[model samples]
Target: MLTTRHFLFFLTGLCCFTISLRAEPAQFEPEAPAAEPGLAFLLPTDQFLRQELDEPDDSDPLLPPPLEDSFSQVEPTPNPDTESLPDLKTLLRPRFDISAEWEPEADGVEMISSDLNLKLPLYPVFGPPPPFLTAGYSFTRINAPVQLDLPRDLHQFSLGVSWMRPLNERWLVRTMLSGVFATDFYNTGSMAWQFRGGMFAIYRPNEEWDLAFGALATGQEDIPVLPVIGATWRPSSSVKVNLMLPNPRISYLISESETRQQWAYVGGGMSGGNWAYNLRDGSPERLNYREWRLVVGWESMPPRTPGRFQSPGASYLIEAGYVFGRKFEREHQAADIKIDNSLLLHSGIRF
Candidate 1:
């Protein structure tokens, strides 16, 4: 018997001999003629090539064929003319506006006096009256005095918020709310608050002209109801001049008493110009009492783009007024109490 290695070598040699004997050559077919080197091949079964050869090729301009004018006699359809549409932007308008201000002031005070007398003297000093003389002498005396010192270092602040809504391109409705806070004059460490609201009919007929007519209402502890008619003229964007007639209603109670008195006042104020930080004193007639106040202060609106009607980022206001004159009292039988003039100042934000 042969070894396993010799038998494996003999089987490999026999497989190689069998593979060489089975190898065969492929049969060749004849080649067709080549027309043009760059031309794409077309199948013999293509539909266009199967049609009749008599039809003329309209694609090749260099090859002219005999033609009758019958094809040219076909009429062409005409297209209707259409107009271009206008853009939406050209049919609409844009508007913008803004208003705001700040005010601050210092100095304020109040004083009071009272008379404790209730009865008249029995004896007539000048003349004899038939019915007046009471035999017994009973005299009633009246005398009382009170004084309040307001804080000497006083600060008051105010802020205003205004909105303007466009009515067409040149007109707007304007409204505003303003609030003020300051240290109480008599209480020293206490605070006082005042609020005011205004509404206006504003007209801007041209770029260089502005006019407004409005009414304002202001409220506080001493002067609870203040109604005013206001007008403003703006010759330029940064300049404004204003005039106002304010009717202030004042209410006060007698010292250590429950009796309250209410009175109305009509007054007027004038400011130099828009950017001017000066206000002339306002003088108004008192209805039930004689009272006077002198105010000098500055107010300014927030800076904003001319056409952007929006809330001001922040605003400040200041006012300093002095109260003088007299107040009558039934307790003070002989004379009225004099209110010494004092300073009031305030400053704050609009929000």
Candidate 2:
């Protein structure tokens, strides 16, 4: 089963790899800089163990002291004995994020959504979850004219769990499960089971690139089954391309003297998930809602505080975007109805 993210990352990597293979490879810049933990704000929301997956909060990491060591040698120099390697579970830690998005009514329709995610590295109450476990909750609501449209409240709540583990030094696995609860009436034959699952084996060829392939699937009717093949690359300290995928961003680090560890990037990705709701004063058929998003945003950490890894993480963000290619599809309404493009305005905290 492929989630939206599975497809996003998959397509992103495939496109980038194809282009790179065709073009001559340039000398990589200085063994690719460590993925800065401060940029956790830039991660894709749909990823499992997000911050940890890319750059876990490691107080002390046992990585090769020199970049060349990772590529040239199977074992690093300082650690002649591989048995003494630090366990990744110790480097992993709990992480959480919360954010909300809203769009003004367009064509007499409006939508709002919010999400909260927590990665429980400390799940055993005494120790950590062997690999890693995460829990997420999402709430969405779409308001429309009751008189003109059916009295269907297109609201949904989703609870999901994600499990991740490093299969080996070069491969990591991520899987997810989500359940849907809707605020609409349905018959015994109707049920809204928005279950989605994905499995990806990701490989880090070097410090700057991550390659992965898998499959993403969903039980929802609107979203399609996606075969995953993706790539994540950072050509330089400030430029990153996720390929033909979601959450691609280009950032500029502001002067350090600015008090806040300030940085800004403009990014965008696919938004909206399938929702099932019954029609009123009509047939027993239901409808599915979906949309695509394009956003430009700026986010910065709280000033004069410990960084995201050390203390509770917090960031200020403001984003303006547009949602288009919106549609509603179902059996009775077999034909998808196009919704007008709407302006998206969002102000939220990521903590």
Candidate 3:
């Protein structure tokens, strides 16, 4: 068995990254927190899943972290402290995203889509590497009113586990593995599905800068495996510049009140996913979707309630972005639908 080493080596050299490239909203858009195979800018293996392990807000956050990042179609970055998290039993969060203005329909194929990601974090697990560890379960759904896909919907359910270990004081190793099961849009699903995930080594040489590189794999035919990298630099306490263009965001902390905190940033990343569809005549089929985005958003977090499991009150966001590279492909079937660029609006809340 070649294992995944050769694939990893091949991908290691593919650094021709793009923020204009889109992603497949496979299972979680992060809150990208998408480590979701991240690249997702939270953008992850679900990735580049908004690339969360936290719903980066690509399913991730640029200013503040959102709660979604489970199976968002785009990879985004959610701003996480990345330092230490207060001990908690679990965290329950959810998020949703919608894209519109798809133009030049494909043969009467309307081009608007929406997706939702519900993130469940099972905290309190012990770690052999990092000080703490946890497992994650994310549920996601994507919808589009279009042709070539039967049953009117697509679904993804995933289970994952992650370990964050620190090497010395400046290096960190974050590893994650997730298994995803998706319905064929028209049928009751079976265990036969897909898998995607990543493992990263992060260097936090100091608070002002961080660097990372890793391997991300999505067991899709068109892209079976690939590599990923990320770098974050904070010039000031409130300003962040990201070198990971695919899902990069320049963020600023606008204000901080005991009961409220606000942040904002702009970034972009890849988005897309693979889903099984049915032919118009009701036959089994599969299709792949890929796209890109430029996102600008603001997020606010209300005070945290007093408790280990208390709510962070509520966090909300308003976002606007332009999306491009909308393509529906099934190359072997010679069905390549090029979707027009569109503008999208987003609103989300974490309870």
Best prediction by TM-score: 2
Better of 1 and 3 by lDDT: 3
- TM-scores, each model vs. reference: 0.29, 0.66, 0.65
TM-score of 1: 0.29
lDDT of 1 by residue, 1-351 (tens): 224663354345434433443312111100101100100111110111111000111111111111111123454333221122222231111111111111111122222111110111112232111011101111111121323211223333444443333444445454546554433233222224445555555454544333445554543333343332333333432333433233221112112212212221222222110000111121111111234444444433333221111223332334455444434222113443344443332222221
Candidate 3, residue 276: lDDT = 63
Clashes of 1: 31
Model 2 earns a TM-score of: 0.66
Runs off by more than 4 Å, candidate 1: 1-165, 174-200, 207-210, 214-230, 246-302, 307-313, 317-321, 325-338
lDDT score, candidate 1, position 55:
13
Ranked candidates, highest TM-score first: 2, 3, 1
- How many angstroms is residue 233 displaced in model 3 relative to the true structure, after the best TM-score fit? 0.5
TM-score, cand. 3: 0.65
Candidate lDDT (C-alpha), each: 0.26, 0.49, 0.49
Question: What does the lDDT read for residue 338 in candidate 3?
Answer: 73
